[model samples]
Target: MSTLRIYISNQCPSCATAIHRVHFVRRLRPEQSVELINLDHQDTVRPSYVFGTPTYCLGNQIIFLGNPSEGELLSKLDQPLSSVKQIT
Candidate 1:
């Protein structure tokens, strides 16, 4: 029941790839809850820890700072949140 939050910005070239990766995860894990946060939007509030675009966070912890391989993303999603380490 954990949610995955993807923080993206319109200016980032790799954000699209990260968005696609989220879709890929959704297709494979339909039960997982994923939220996409676009920093470019004025209503969206950027998290203090997120210094760059295409950041993926599971709960409050950042899992990846940029676009990650589909396999790596899936692997992290499959593991317990406590065991998953932050990836840059």
Candidate 2:
């Protein structure tokens, strides 16, 4: 298992898209843990490099910079996951 942290901002469409990707991954792998951090409420240590909302970080490394298809997202996540099942 890995730490899947998603930074989101309220009232942002891109944020919603990112959320969808997280849920999609979670659906396929229920054992994985996911955390949704609100940028509005949390002081992310580093926000400069990330392009925009919907940024995804697997553990302490960024796996995705923008909203990507569930497939692409899964591949990055798979790199750190101990177990994962593919879902269409």
Candidate 3:
């Protein structure tokens, strides 16, 4: 199963909004697994490239750098896996 991993930080001003949007997306796409990783926690392990809050990752790729609009996010999520671009 494919998963959507959302990385967030407590100190980021936009983190709250990004989290809310993710939750909303979850409700709309039950088939897709959503994981929230809080970078503020010392034990959290993430890719070194994920340096910003509100980063969205699908599989091993970073899909979005910040908060994305609901329509845009849904469009990306709904696409066939082969069509989704790989961003390391």
Candidate 4:
């Protein structure tokens, strides 16, 4: 299984919504591992890795940007790697 990482900026309004959505989804599925990275305080040197706030990275590769719907997030997680190309 791939890991999910959400890159966020605390100061961003959209990031706040994205954060809530991600947590809600995580709470529904406790078995899934989801990590949040706050760009404002984290030592993130490569801004390119996180092109913008509220970006979702799966297994070190960016998969989604901005706020994603619950269905979309779940679909991506359920998909096999062979079906979709990883951004990395």
Task: Say which candidate scores most in lDDT.
Answer: 1
Pull out the clashing pairs in model 3. none
What TM-score does each of the candidates earn?
A: 0.92, 0.73, 0.90, 0.83
lDDT of 3 at 57: 85
Off by over 4 Å in 1: 85-88
Pitting candidate 1 against candidate 2, the one with the higher TM-score is 1
lDDT of 4 by residue, 5-85 (tens): 888886788887777867886888788788888888857654466778888877767778887888888888888856655
> After TM-score superposition, what is the CA distance of residue 23 in candidate 4 from its true location, in Å?
1.6
| lDDT digits (tens) for residues 1-88 of candidate 2 | 6688888878667888877777887799788789887777756564565556777877656667677788887777667443333222
User: Local distance difference test, per candidate?
Assistant: 0.89, 0.71, 0.85, 0.78
Backbone clash pairs for candidate 1 read none
lDDT of 1 by residue, 1-88 (tens): 6799999999999998988987898899999999999999999998788999899999888989888899999988989987866544
Listed per model in order, the count of residue pairs whose N, CA or C atoms clash below 3 Å is 0, 0, 0, 0
Deviation in Å, model 3, residue 5 alpha carbon: 0.5
Per-residue error for 76 in candidate 2, Å, reads: 1.2
TM-score of 3: 0.90
Provide the lowest-lDDT 10-residue window in model 2: 79-88
Show the colliding residue pairs in model 4: none
How well is each residue in 1-88 modelled by candidate 3, as lDDT tens digits? 5688999998999889888877898799888899889998999987887989899888877778999888888888888767777764
Report model 2's TM-score to 2 decimal places: 0.73
Rank candidates, lDDT, best first.
1, 3, 4, 2
